[model samples]
Target: MSAHAINDRRHGQTTLAHFFFAFVRGPCKLLSSGAWGERCRLAKFGGECIHSDFHICEDAGRMGNHVASELPKSCDVENLWLCERASVVMAKFSVLLFLREQWTVLVVTGTNVGLGFEAAVHLAKLKPKRLLLTTRDEAKCKQAKQDVEQCSVTNNIEAWPLELGSFDSVRKFADRIESEGFPINAFIANASIATFTYAKTQDGWETTLQVNYLSTALLSILMLPHLIKSTTASDTARLVIVASDAHFRANKLKGVANWPSILGKLNDEEYCTASVMKNRYELSKLLQVMFVREPASRLPNPTPVSVTSINPGFCHSRLTRSVESNLVMKLMVHVGKALLARTTEMGSRALMHPAVEPSERDRHGRYMSCVEVAEESDYALSEEGKEISRRLWEETIEILAKIDPRVNQIISQHLLAR
Candidate 1:
């Protein structure tokens, strides 16, 4: 490291910027290439025309050894297509770096419309090698694929069918993904459903619990193995779980410390059959947060994967369609959409930030409240809270195992028996 970088670290402000440059420099060196002239690429493509954006010219070989001699210092050679892979392989060695080559394969659920669709549009601009757009309806997934591919000249965009309401269906979808042998870079758990009434899915769980949290948890576990296939040692595949700020509103978790019994208590037949699920959605969000926070500890040390939860905030999308069914509720949601809620596109920024950027290692198992890492609910802050999270994680694994023993096999292979 340079003395300037060491000194910058002491002060903190210049740390990431200095590290970023140094990180990129190491890989360019590996490619045995020198920086190019500012307009070198454009000069080849469009006859000496100049553009400020960094890009590569077709003929480095034609430039001969003069590549080093005719270079402009201001141009970033790191941005060239020539060094793309090397730079990507090395840039992530440091948590401070976010620069990466285009992801080879990425997955997004619930992409038919809403924040998932918005996030898909933004991701398309990055030009991932392949994009997996999933939804409950095959027709919707098809439309979403068209909508996403239209945003950029991306390579391959595929549509997959997923129904989160049934564990059996989730297991089948996950099994198909794992068996397909496609290298996955990131999995965006964006499929979620909200309900005002207490209803049970085919899996015999409350609708909100099954769809919003359990299905996401199961899909993430199944996808963990694929994420472990990152090409380089410095890199880790990302899991971006979209949650909501309503987590704080799950007052039922306040003062509860025993995690194993809590799910049972919440799932008691009498409780579901007799009660009106007023705060079920909020409770489900809280459970998702807990799952995100617990995965790191369960995974092997220096974890080969990074997990994070994102709150898109109170956004207006198809998510509001349920509330829209009631006249008064629809008016209130409409007002929220107009006056306070973020538009679907704007809210997708929450996923965009983590999806494209390499987050700080400290952020693993943390809640990303929008672009910032914000404090979680007080119910999640204590030592006992950690125990609760662990217990919930175990219960989730145990219960899901009864549904599919392969869940145990995957856990053992990736996180547990290692």
Candidate 2:
């Protein structure tokens, strides 16, 4: 584009922004409450009256370092600084944020260890605008940051504290990201836990389900707006869930036989007993695959983001070490390692392959195994399973919204009916 055209475009955007802010501020012109019991007489003079204290105009007024010693007679002005009142100092720090150039913000959860750590190291080499590496422990994250920085000096890696075991922690992390207003260039939901003892998070859900599926889904929804806006017409943003082919291995779920209505019962102690320990992990992955399908289906053609699940193919990670207490299971895992386990670096490639490269738009919801677009289980595609997936998505949204109100806002803002 020519410089003239570029200038024209910026001018048009600025004009439209001014008109938009004017429309918004028009109805917000109300009486500003004075000190304590006192009130402005602007309303008494038949001037515009705004009852709300959290006016965007007022917030925008405090934009620069410039200050005004007294109130301006009218809101109209060439510069916002000209209308400042009572030595108001515009907040320079906050205003500077708007002036900074946009950058790609990629998030990799559980980055303090294993596959997540390797992926963060790989992403760091790309020199992303900001790489948010998340782990439950602060000390581990501090170490993880040092390790990732070793890959590249200018890696804008920030270790964010996230504890998937607690609902409040997950909500807090998601809220902090939203408040920062970073565009989600890519979000990798890589945190998951496998437990043989059938533990539960503070939210009361089964530990495996909460860490692998529930919290990941909640974070995905919370980040949807940022993801959508960052996505371009030609190349959309990426949403990757580290799912496994173990999903197909899940069999004869007890309470889940009732499905949607009994979804909450998966956390029941009896339901998650030793007999079903490994099966619960498989079920969580299956639920994740189902989740991948629902959101892609809900989106319009040539979707703005890809929601994908991948199988790293029995990778050599500590995920399976949870069953070490069972001698037989431990022996199987030990033998399976030598026979088929991919190195963590190789497994990390499975995530990076789909993430960094562009694929056909129709591939948005597809399952991937070993860097190839592969088929999900028949049950995941069957009519009955589709119904279960839909119900699960709705139920998941309801559960997440109850945890944090922001989930609702993010979903409605980014997702439109096909």
Candidate 3:
């Protein structure tokens, strides 16, 4: 969906391969053969390439941009659309093939619209035993269920109410799932918000902190027992937390380390100013990247659960609607989306890759982008960041334990068990 055709032959850049990198701007794999030839070599993703008529093929690892085939010399920007379409179709077909034989139950959060709704529709095509969708609004939840039902062949789709702002609501939803006693094969935490306005949830924490980080951690921790219980010899349950590329921008947290508590400092009102609010959403996602790293280390080796985070790659979504009141921010989002944004449907495919793709050990605790394992921010991989992540994890568990006694019990029974 982020495809663009660059045809400035006057600039000495006229090859189809050059246009390929301009189209996706990320890692891609060669999908099929084209009229140009059967010997198309893949270039290293994000690497400098010397294009030469698409004749020379070089072998890189299983990570790069995927092209169906080379374009003919006579073709120009008009044929680039075919290459884009082939890339999307191939991605869909690849994921669907892995999911065809699966019959597991899946739970996707934040499914009222955008990435969540689109992911639910694709997951339903797997004919899972049950597909559960969660939304903050009941009417919208019902409408989403109907929409996904119409697109999918399965009739077992059900919509549920979940508000990430309230710990009580999160508890009730988890309790209902526990009562149902259904084995969950995957739980996709896709619901999140971004705003320049500063507000707190009914539970007393900052709105973005509670909805995006605290409550998300709470729900996923609560669901661990169910996820682990559902794992089998050949199949493992997956926990996919929808994080973001914005986390790379959260490099201003140096002062917070000197504070008594990390989460405490983040929740303080003084830190919620206009300039700070601009980066708060990115900070919350940074915490999520840590969440993926820390607790995953606690789980035993060869564990049956796969915990991973993903960046949906800046889709044209309703996530920015809350910040539209600020004219400056509104203009920025308008320009950003126009320049670099994928459609909601294409963005959802990245979300679906982790939910259904077959992998157990190597994929665990990894950050995926463009449907492949990607490097985290430089800070997130540093020693200081790891230390901060450790403290944040400790504080998060302690707070969540107070909210629900089951937090500690689940950690002991599921995570700590040897």
Candidate 4:
């Protein structure tokens, strides 16, 4: 049979048995060519095609040698067109197979750099159907997309600019996604801001709290409806907050027993105090965990969404660059991190693992370190903490409403629609 005739017959069978038989027979035709040169060219095409199709075909060796035997050495299949056609066919088959099986979506924040970037890279390999990455900088988003593209070409991933500090930006971003009709299966509130000096967002809120906590809260609220709508019985939706060990330190320093009230009044002295500076970043992370835990605990019976918080451990990334830059501070930070510091890839494992791994029994609302579920501080798990988180949620909604009424209305409508 002609190669074309065999390919036509094999088109209907995407199963492994048929694919291997057809692939081998197609290339084995060239084996009859006595010329050594012709045989060599055929072998090249067979090898290249097999390499490209490895992910699609389950049995590696079965299809490989079959293609090698048929190709003639004289007929070099090095033409880009042939290569492109092979890739497209493989991709189409792979995608169809993937779609037939259950799939999930993951939304990763601050994917442009550091821990967020590392997490996105790892998650892509797990084969989520869709991965959405958000960053405040468009240029950074483009770079992130490029980085992911290099790693796993089959995964469908997208990047968008999302400035968490601005209510306007967050609302606009959410609106765009809603209008486009994208579903969210999981969300990671991983973006955060910290500085040795203080700064305010465009909306006049403190930069650290605004970016690290408020904006993330707003985005989650905005996206909650889609998350709920997209969830299925076969799958459990999740919200993973990338929190920190600094949370424990924050609880110790501030007599501030509550989460929201801690943000109530920050005098210059409180803001600049040595303890405050060191713990402010940690406090923001703690608030995030508490904030997620509050709503997560309140879902109706048989909740559709499960929430958890995790600390990626100390990593050598841009987040810690400030401490690494100064001589004395760098030494101190290095010494501290060495005891527990993980590389970026290692640090991101916990974050990525939680998103992909199935939930453990009775593991919701727990804190995670090194991907193993751990306990949050007693203060964070107390009734006072829950109350404080609830109050903080209310206060946050009020503040955002004042900043952008449209966002408040949109979120309210989303909740109501649910």
Model 4 Cα shift for residue 94 (angstroms): 16
Higher-ranked by lDDT: 2 or 4: 2
Better of 3 and 4 by lDDT: 3
Per-model TM-score on C-alpha atoms? 0.73, 0.72, 0.80, 0.69
TM-score of 1: 0.73
lDDT of 2 by residue, 1-418 (tens): 2111111232222122322222222222222221111122222111333231222233443633332223344532223322233122322222222222125677899988788987787677655678899989889889999998986565578998998888888888877887898788688888888766777767888888888888888888877777787887656788888887667665534445465454576767876667777578888888999998878787766788888887665567888777777899889888877765656765675666556554636458888765456666656766767777888888898888899898777667667653
Predicted structure 1: lDDT? 0.65
Better of 1 and 2 by TM-score: 1
Question: Lowest summed lDDT over 10 consecutive residues: which window, candidate 3?
Answer: 30-39
The reply for model 4, stretches above 4 Å from the true place, is 1-102, 252-261, 266-274, 382-384, 404-418
Error of 3 at 154 (Å): 3.0
Clashing pairs in 2: 30-49, 30-50, 31-50
lDDT of each: 0.65, 0.66, 0.74, 0.61
Put the candidates in TM-score order, highest first: 3, 1, 2, 4
lDDT of 4 by residue, 85-131 (tens): 23111222235324522366789999888889877886675567788
On lDDT, the leading prediction is 3
